[model samples]
Target: MSDTTVTSSSIRNLIKANIRNYSMVLMLALIMIIFSFLTDGVNLNSRNFTNIFMQNSYILLLAVGMVLVIIVGNIDLSVGSVAAFIGAISAMLYNSGANMFVTILLSIILGVLIGAFQGAWIAYAKIPAFIVTLAAQLLFRGLTYIITNVSPISLRDDNFKQIASGMANINVLTINGVYYTALVAGVVVFLIYVVLEIQGRRNKIKYGFKVSPMSFFIIKLLVIGLLIFGLSQRFATYRGIPIVVIVLGVTIIFFSFITNNTVIGRYIYAVGGNARSAKLSGINSELVVFVVQLIMGGLTGLAGVVFTGYMNSALPQAGNNFELDAIAACFIGGASASGGIGTVIGAIVGGLVMAAINNGMSLMNIQAQWQYVVKALVLLLAVFYDIYTRRKTGLG
Candidate 1:
């Protein structure tokens, strides 16, 4: 091939490989801008911005686990149902005068058992994940209904309520009506993010891998820093800092580290890429699948707790359609349909995108049916984009 042709081909391939990464972020920004305008700037109001996090917290947690499942070439349609079942259990325990700590622990244990049961059927018995989780979806939902007997379980514990709705106890300062606690937290987080990113780039250089230009890197960090600080300021105006946000931040950091820097993470991608090939390479594909599901279940339990706390009760229908939202977030954030590709950050952005759309539409008094249609179209387009890119790169 001519040098010019070769250069053009390489550029095209690069774009195909990474377009989703850029597009997801840009799409979120675009959505925020559009919704801000559509809602007459109501969407960007301090209270509304905080509501976005509080409302979508559980979904984000589910999306974190969902992305990992997708990366391993599996799906867990039962997450929402499992969450509801666990939440129901927690509510019953709380109402029975059980200690909040004990209630949480038992709920998580229930989640583990449920995940292990489904994982065994799918991984050990050689059943398809779709069938196993689909069955689980019905089973768990039915269990939730049976346990609650079609009634909502109310929680009247103040300590339990703080799990999702409480603010941070720390106070940095109160300056000109802006709570400095949020800003300080944002600054600390931004510094940590920047340091880790720069260190990662250095490691890439040390390993003889390609790296982005310093200019590009700096600009990217600046943009992300501003976004972090900007949102923190907004959050400060409402509540100093939400406890759930702190929980989410910690979870994201931990999972992001594991997926990028751990051996098990590589095995997950390998199995997803080709399970048979991975097994032949001496990787225990079944064990990996089993462990992934177990982790997913634990996270689902955590989500259940947060969600239950958020509503101050657990209704039989509380988690209805939550799985769909989590799955959509993964795909929309750029997870490959056939698996072996995704990121923690992408899933967060995708969930935020979904949350933004839902929140914005509700603010405008749009009907539920139309909201569903719009979200369905958006999810379809996102999957289509994934397929188009994969085919272009001959990976489909």
Candidate 2:
């Protein structure tokens, strides 16, 4: 074969292999560009960019936990209700003169216990996860109403409210209306990413695995680095990085490490990919499911705290449809319907896609109902893509 033909064939194979990894990112970019034009550039405003993270932080958190649950071949319908209940409890505690830290700790503990309770029924008793979580959803929703007396509990503590609404500007420097601290942080992040990528490539080469061409690798780094730097500059032009963004960032990093680097993470994929085979191989599938539930419950509680802070109150109807948003994000981010095929970063990107859609539609003054219709369509298309890919690969 001619050298040109071989080069073209290799490029085709590379694109085919990496399409799934980059498709959602491209889709997100496309949606942002389209919405920016539709909204006369309002969608790309710096303030609006920050609002995207602040407003959807809780949903993103739920998505992180939900993806893990889905990967374990289960679903937790109760997270929204659980978050509501936990938020209500936290508010009551704060009103009753409890310390803010204490209230937060107790709320998270309560959420963990609730998770364990439901997990026992699903994992040990072998009740269907769907049924158990569904019942808990109703049970907790009712409990929230009872505790809050069907009214909103106003939070008078500004410090507690800052958990979601505050900014973390370091006041180190500024250059042409951009915060230097944020710019520096962005540079640091890019550097770390570069290191990791090089190390990963080196390991692949060491293992005799085919690696991307050096030119393609350099292009990838440049593209991603520019994106990171630009995003930081955007945020710096605004009020600086949000407290919630920091929290969300930490959650993403932690969960990504857990899912990508840990032994339990491997077990989760193994169990989800084939429970029978995992069990036959002496893996404790039940324990994995239970532990995952506990983690989900804890994250749901943390999300509750953040949401309550964002609202500045614990409302009786808080967290409505949150589970739906999280589930949709997981699916849109390329998670498999049959489980065992998702990533933490993908879930976050999926969440950002949902946030962008909601934010952009609102900016364009579209009706809320129409927004729902559009979201439904997007979700359907995402699932269709998943099915198509699976069938194409003969995995379905």
Candidate lDDT scores, in order, read: 0.89, 0.89
Error of 2 at 99 (Å): 3.4
lDDT of 1: 0.89
Work out the TM-score per prediction. Answer: 0.94, 0.94
Worst 10 residues of 1 by lDDT: 9-18
Instruction: Give me the displacement of residue 361 in model 1, in angstroms.
Output: 1.0
Error of 2 at 116 (Å): 1.5
Q: Give lDDT tens digits, candidate 1, residues 1-396.
A: 699897677667656666778798899999989988898999998989888998999999999999999999999899999999999999888888889789888888888888899889988999999999999999989999999999988887667767788877875577777778998899999998988898878878998987655766788899899889989989888767888899899989888877876889889999999999999999999999998898889889989999999998898998888999999999999898888999988999999999999999999999999999999999999999999877877888
Q: Report the C-alpha lDDT of model 2 over 146-219, residue by residue, as the tens digit.
A: 99999999986777778788888563577777777877878887887788679768967997989989999999
Regions of candidate 2 where Cα sits further than 4 Å from its true position: 2-10, 169-171, 175-177, 202-211
**Candidate 1 residue pairs that clash:** none
Query: What's the CA RMSD of model 2 in angstroms?
Result: 1.9
Model 1 vs. true fold: TM: 0.94
lDDT of 1 at 21: 81
